[model samples]
Target chain A: MGGDFGPQVVVPAAVEAAREGIAIALVGDEAVVNAELAGCDAEGLDIRVVHASQVVEMDDKPADALRRKKDSSIQVACRLVKDGEAHGVVSAGNSGATVACGMFVLGRIKGVQRPALAGILPTEKNPVVLIDVGANVDSKPQHLFQFGLMADVFARDVLGLDKPSVGILSIGEEEGKGNAAVREAFDLLKKSQLRFIGNVEGRDIFTGEVDIVVCDGFVGNVALKLSEGLATSLGRILKDELKSSWLSKLGTLLSMRAFKRFRKVTDYAEYGGAPLLGLKDIVLVAHGKSNQLAMVNCIRMAATSVRNRAHEHLVEKLADHQGLNGKSEKSAA
Target chain B: MGGDFGPQVVVPAAVEAAREGIAIALVGDEAVVNAELAGCDAEGLDIRVVHASQVVEMDDKPADALRRKKDSSIQVACRLVKDGEAHGVVSAGNSGATVACGMFVLGRIKGVQRPALAGILPTEKNPVVLIDVGANVDSKPQHLFQFGLMADVFARDVLGLDKPSVGILSIGEEEGKGNAAVREAFDLLKKSQLRFIGNVEGRDIFTGEVDIVVCDGFVGNVALKLSEGLATSLGRILKDELKSSWLSKLGTLLSMRAFKRFRKVTDYAEYGGAPLLGLKDIVLVAHGKSNQLAMVNCIRMAATSVRNRAHEHLVEKLADHQGLNGKSEKSAA
Candidate 1:
């Protein structure tokens, strides 16, 4: 079973997805999956339960889980995609294991150097794609360029942007302002066919200045999680403030609609299921703490990706990516 | 001449700091400094103006500025410290140049591998020190370990934490979860005498779970700026919502005290200037966009560091650092 609540949360989410007319394969402990499924109204729904004997624990190492847990829920789910029984895989469980399963089991696209996780976050105007959030670390410049290429293709194909501007994340916005990898990656991106918009700082990630922000997995993951942490901490502070005074308490009720509107703009769950980019098959990683609603939204996103031929586009676009990045291809890796 | 509104901002701030009984030697172009100082109420204050011909533009490369701007204001300020004319240097100008000046002019403490910038950020409970916010990049394991060590001493001597808990920033809070350097640093930190709290994720930075979070300059800088950007963006969204309706306007007035308290907890300026640690003398780098109030606090913070003998503690503690980290020292660098 994957995620925090395993079958309990996932089953209801799958049922909801099925009701939304998306076919879902509930791959988990058969007994538990069945028990949870029995509680849902699943009449005439195209939802099937595939038994997975083992679970990938949150603390399990990706490599260890990949090697030892062949029958793990994440593995079985990925296997369904490889066998053509499923269009995509969605998991809220061990994210590292999900990524491992996606890479080792599902394999990589032909021209892909390293498959990465693209975290879609809401900005002021639109969704910004931050690639290589945590899929791989210690990335070479070539890998970062590929992450940019892959994310660019995703933004155009899935997000329906006509032309996506890409920016490599750095400490400063200047040409020679980043670490060795970023400095080199800047050159690679500058030579690429994608609408490369030089370097952007971490502050620029949430500014919606560019459609995609490319970084090595380590920094990207740190930035991603830091954003979430900051949001939570700020929310807690605001909540405490709103509750401190009787006048503010009255203000809270009157300002309820404003808060709701603010939530719609800031909620990461609103943009569900960040797809692991450059993979041969679709594998979406939901948050470890995702609820039933968030998971259902993730499943919906997975189905939408399949419908949009997101994987096929990545495969085809990477061929162009290689040719477009020919200048730095020799020096980047 | 370093940051925006150079003399205008720095002069008023220096005047304010001097009014508080802190001696300030303002290093800048003579005529401009004199003009700004003439406007300020500097009567009975310990403030002096030292003329420097050149100004280090914000976009100037650190190395370029170091080599070319020898007569720059920042350098003159650092030279003042080096000549023992001033106890410390405080600059709201070019940070990279400021770090370079701190390192080259004042020199590093014995056994210090690299000088770093330790940014002090406010959390709910206390201030957290994030080291190497933008001093250097492409950090080795030893560099990060040193950052942790330096920040630990900073927390103890300056922030008044008796035994500061230190954590290496990583994707996961496990021993072997980060990149190669972080994994190596994690082990090194574990072996040290400092209260090594194992690995901490980016989200833990604001939780006040640890007194110090150590990362490479690239990632640390990104994290620092991202926090500032997030606060601004979120504030914008909240303001837009609050102003949308009439009832929320009344609520905002009632919630004024709460918002003020929230700002107090979140203001980076409230913590004053971030010191450039590992230097022989105290050098504090304030925000480039620092207002008069912010810069005044920076000067006060610099004065406080000198009074606290922060440099003496770092030099003394690093000897213990070498011994405690004997297992990884040979391998870390």
Candidate 2:
């Protein structure tokens, strides 16, 4: 009901998670959800089925989903977290709708100005967290600073980094390398207590040297989408070239196992989903075409993020940093 | 003297170009240029050494390079084009210095708002041109429209794409998808006579469906650098995974021929250098770590661009389009 695979992938994944002693709620059309669940070993597992009357289509606008789809699975899941019935919510649905649900249903964190979406991209060294991947496109310098602060807290608390290095994504690494907004953001980040590594170019995103890369949503989204497009294009070209010749075809045959491992390492399914940070509750948005493996990992990520108390740490850290704290709810928006 | 590989890569490339009857001018410190040239089969080649007293370091600011390093290799090359001693200029030097030299030395074409650096990225399909890749950041809607105009001209004249479809790069493809600048630019592109394909997302860059993907310098630069970083990182990860086990390692050995073919197809050197479009004279900038192969391709690109008379076509087309024309030189800037 949520993803391209619908309840088929979601129910099996939920059943597996329940078997592992993780509490799970399947939020979708009850009839469809039960049909998919019937195929799984869900007997005596810690799982509950929650019904929602509407579905948010892939092409549906986020605003429309928020307004019309009040009884949508995504909204219900988010409401569950808001009501303290669930620690987190996971959706392999329309990311824009999921982001909207996170903000509109759950609301923003106490002092947060904008909730940033962190796209966790895996590198050879470690996974790099790129924040503001299209959550708030026209971001201000203060919003960028808040993004940095929240990402820093999330990196330390959820990602298990002791002291994560935050780098401002720009055209160049030089102090005055970027546009006005970036330069102003740099000045703010320099004064912050977070381990700001100064400006990092787009090339630095995959280096894995920096833990948290912060930017306005437009730039981050472009970087994320570009990586995805290129990776797919490159893989296609590599495979085409490998199969072009007899010698290469033989080599590909012998290397199938290695290729599988390489795919696993770079697969979006392995990473599961990206977390929408700066929200009051945890919300993870998986890819729309997420499979069973991806759904399972999405649940795992939600559990981990909830267990780590990322939102609480974010609140505490922001409160401790006087510059980011003490804003009234009215001023926060 | 320009790139990291310096005279070692540059001299041989120049000699090779000269061997093919492409008149080549080797610009750098005279002594170092001669020593490197001696290693080449330069017995009787159409090659001349142009001595420049200074070298623009990679970290040197563009303005500093323009004002202080007057006799630098990059400056000398652009000056050659300006003085009509050379048809075009090519340098595997600092890109900032290249763009600055192009603007200051060669000047911008009449009716052109800003000269953009078009980074030609190779894909499985036809090569796609991404314009304004760090030439002029904080660009206005007018500047972005100018980028599309210039890139469209370059694609047709140099890249040989007849009536190339130009798309404005943004976070989404919808007309109203992007930030303020992009939305404005979208309106402008639609009104213009160019083959505007509306807005394209980051994922569209590699599909090779669109000929030119235009954006402000900052966004374009991020897209370019991110692609380079991800391609390199992905290749490394794939190779590492292939060698992780003995079975896969054996496959890699068998697939060595196929791997070489794959590398060749995806090689950046094959594309040579990116042209700084909308300038009065052609100026191509190669990568900083460009080897001899890249240098050779840069020269080839420069020659092709010059032969196509891209600048003249750009000026004529821009002047014809009233939306861009009717501006004095002062107002244009």
Give me the runs in candidate 2 sitting further than 4 Å from their true place. A324-333, B244-246, B324-333
Measured with DockQ on alpha carbons, how good is candidate 2?
0.71
Write model 2 residue lDDT over B1-333, tens digit each, in one string.
888888888889888888877898888899999988887789878899999999999889989999999999999888887888888888888888888889988888776778888888887788889988888888887888888888888888888888999999888777799888888778778888899999898888998999889888999988888888877877787787788788778878877876776576567888888898888888889988788888888888788778888878887888767644433222434
Give lDDT tens digits, candidate 1, residues B1-333.
666768888888888888888988988899999988899888878888899999999888889999998999999999999999999998878888898888988899988888899998888677789998988899888888888888887887777789999989999876788899999888788878889988888889888878999999999999999888887788788888888889888888878777787777667767767899899999999887777788888888788778889888887788877664465667864
Per-residue C-alpha lDDT of model 1 across residues A1-333, encoded as one tens digit per residue:
677777788889899999988988999889988988899999899989899899999989899999999999999989999999999999999998898899999999887888999999988888899998998899989899989888987887778899999999999877888999999988878877889999899788887778999999999999999988888887788889899889888887878877786676667777877799888888999987778888888898788788999878877777776665565667763
- The TM-score that candidate 1 achieves is 0.96
Cα error, residue B136 of model 1, in Å, equals: 0.9
Query: What clash count does candidate 2 reach?
Result: 0
DockQ of each: 0.77, 0.71
Against the true structure, what is each candidate's TM-score?
0.96, 0.95
- Best-fitting candidate, measured by lDDT? 1
User: Which CAPRI level is candidate 1?
Assistant: medium
